[model samples]
Target: MNIPSDLKYTKSHEWIRVEGNVGTAGITDFAQQELGDIVFVEAPAQGSAVAAGAPMGSVESVKAVSEINAPASGTVSAVNADLTDHPELLNADPYGKGWILKITFANTGELSGLMDAAAYAAYVAESAH
Candidate 1:
């Protein structure tokens, strides 16, 4: 439940931190918690093109495997290589060291479609029942 106010959130439980035209994407703290103990992360290759809402990677947990979607259309500039060997970081610090990918987005305007921290918190709360 560590929803940082500055980040944008997708309904699927991904968060994006945009800086200039580059966006850092990751599963939300709520997502990591729901997935349980993360055992593996399969990230898209660097330079890959991903569309908004498309699966860019996947995370495997002790309980189940879940797809990680892109929050906006972009060319993936980097992948969090550290997660391949240390998937537990997703559970340890999802918002910081556990961030999954960085993309050079085609349009910053698409960001308006995402939720802010307050809206996302309410969305998560409503989904709980």
Candidate 2:
């Protein structure tokens, strides 16, 4: 499980990297591993409003289809168009080029509700057992 220490995580398996009021989000390494061989991504459009914990889009894999949730409330500023062509990037590098959405969040305070890397790791471990 390549859980980066700098990102915040949701129980649903989304991770967010906050920079000022902007956040970039994607499914964690654990999620991609479980989903298996991502084939398609339905990304939210730019300027779309998404609420924290709400489904913004979906990812299709050889194993299953999984909803991608918003980790914070915000207007989506960008979507990774690259995923449309190369969904494998998600499994290959989820934290970097595989980011699904960039959001300009309304309240940075909402981030405190998300789990830090340590807590998320524990959560994943606990869920596994």
Using all chains and alpha carbons, the TM-scores for the candidates as numbered come to 0.98, 0.98
TM-score computed on alpha carbons, candidate 2: 0.98
Candidate 2, 1-129: lDDT as tens digits:
899999999999999999999999999999999999999999889999999999999999987899988999989999998998999999999999999999999889999999999999999999989
Give candidate 2's whole-model lDDT: 0.95
Tens digits of per-residue lDDT for model 1, 16-122? 99999999999999999999999999988999899999888899999899998899998999999899889999999999999999999999999999999999999
Q: Positional deviation of 92 in candidate 1, in angstroms?
A: 0.3
Which regions of candidate 1 deviate over 4 angstroms? Answer: none
